[model samples]
Target: MSIDSTRFILLNTSHYGNIGATARAMKTMGFSDLVLVAPRFADALVHEDTVAMASGAADILVRARVVGSLAEALDGISYACATAMTPRDFGPATHAPRPLFAELARSEHRVAFVFGSERFGMANDDVYRCHACISIPTHPDYGSLNLAQAVQLLAYDWRQALGGFEVAPRVPDASLADGAQVQGLLGHWQQALTDIGFLDPAAPKKLMPRLNQLLNRAELSAEEVHILRGIARAIQRRG
Candidate 1:
């Protein structure tokens, strides 16, 4: 089956440099129509360093759309897979790179591949959102991988899957979390932290910063943020 832009997605990447590199790689594979789902580097733009890495596909960087949530990022995607270095309890047993690639080769539906951040991999809920798991095989002694490395690897396989077939037309997906939804979640998170003694009003110095870092790092999707807010409200009620 031929590949289309709709069959792929990159999620929660934290660096502009990496995003640029990813755009280049996808373009190299003859895939564009990239959707950034609440990437940490939401302010990213086409810069010299990124363009340098993108090489021939620098234009893809300019055309990329940055959205606020994974669900929005993944809207209309028929199949979903999370790329993780480690398997989690909530997800299916992981697949090695080639096997996952082979399976993807067989499928005809739109697929999305999610890559988590540099530090913690995809969260439990995010993994649950995927239909399968793809893991890059690395040295057993040092299994960690950089974000761009992971994206390039998957994109490489997808390119192979295309295998001389012309790529299809682009179809846009919906955004899962709009601005208002994410803001509401942030507000609830802030309130919950304040109410739970996590943020002391008398010395509201370090906590807000740390909370901001955590919330920002999470790259919370609209649905995820709302769900988290609900959990926060539940916790507050119990307290």
Candidate 2:
């Protein structure tokens, strides 16, 4: 697999400093594809603060692509993973980036690891679009990680994976669902749950969240999402 096919996407990044730091982190790990999805500051890549933070890796900031949405950023990517600490009901299965990278290294398709804004992390909608979620192992009482720190960890893993690092004997045989497919499946389920009176949209407490967790653990593939959505449609019609 070409290491150049791997992308590091930052979504709704608010601080130019973080952007710069992220650039440096990626460069240190030999990753160059940097895409910023709707950063808070339009001039983040060129800002003085960003330049100052990037230090020696300003070349990455200069070449970074800025886009309007996550979908746009992930247009041609086959596998997309989200990095976040907050557990979700419908989120992808959480894995350490290292093993995930090792598996990804065997694939020829384009891949992306998306990180949310420093302030709020990724939105549920954005997280839903990813094929998997990565939670950096940390202390239970304090699991918060800086945006750049997270990038560095994943980038390092990808670099190692490219260099033939294997934590296990073999990667699993599975094709993961992309963002749009996952979103459609979730939408179908949401409607079905509403029709069945299983989810009160007005006061949706933990029902959908619980279901998200369940589905994420299932690691549904595209075919599986399609099948599940079919079942959801059936439930909608029956109700």
In candidate 1, which residue pairs get closer than 3 Å at backbone N, Cα or C atoms, i.e. clash? 72-175, 72-176
lDDT of model 1 at residue 214? 71
With a 3 Å backbone cut-off (N, CA, C), the pairs that clash in candidate 2 are 89-212, 89-213, 90-212, 129-179
Candidate 2's TM-score: 0.67
Model 2, residue 97: C-alpha shift (Å): 1.7
Task: For model 2, state the Cα shift of residue 87 in Å.
Answer: 1.3
What is the C-alpha local distance difference test score of candidate 2? 0.87
Worst 10 residues of 1 by lDDT: 1-10
Clashes of 1: 2
List where candidate 1 sits over 4 angstroms from the true fold: 5-7, 164-239
**Model 2, span 165-210: residue lDDT tens:** 4466475766888778877787788888889988899998887778
lDDT tens string, model 1, 160-185? 76564466759654346655776677
Report every candidate's CA lDDT. Answer: 0.72, 0.87
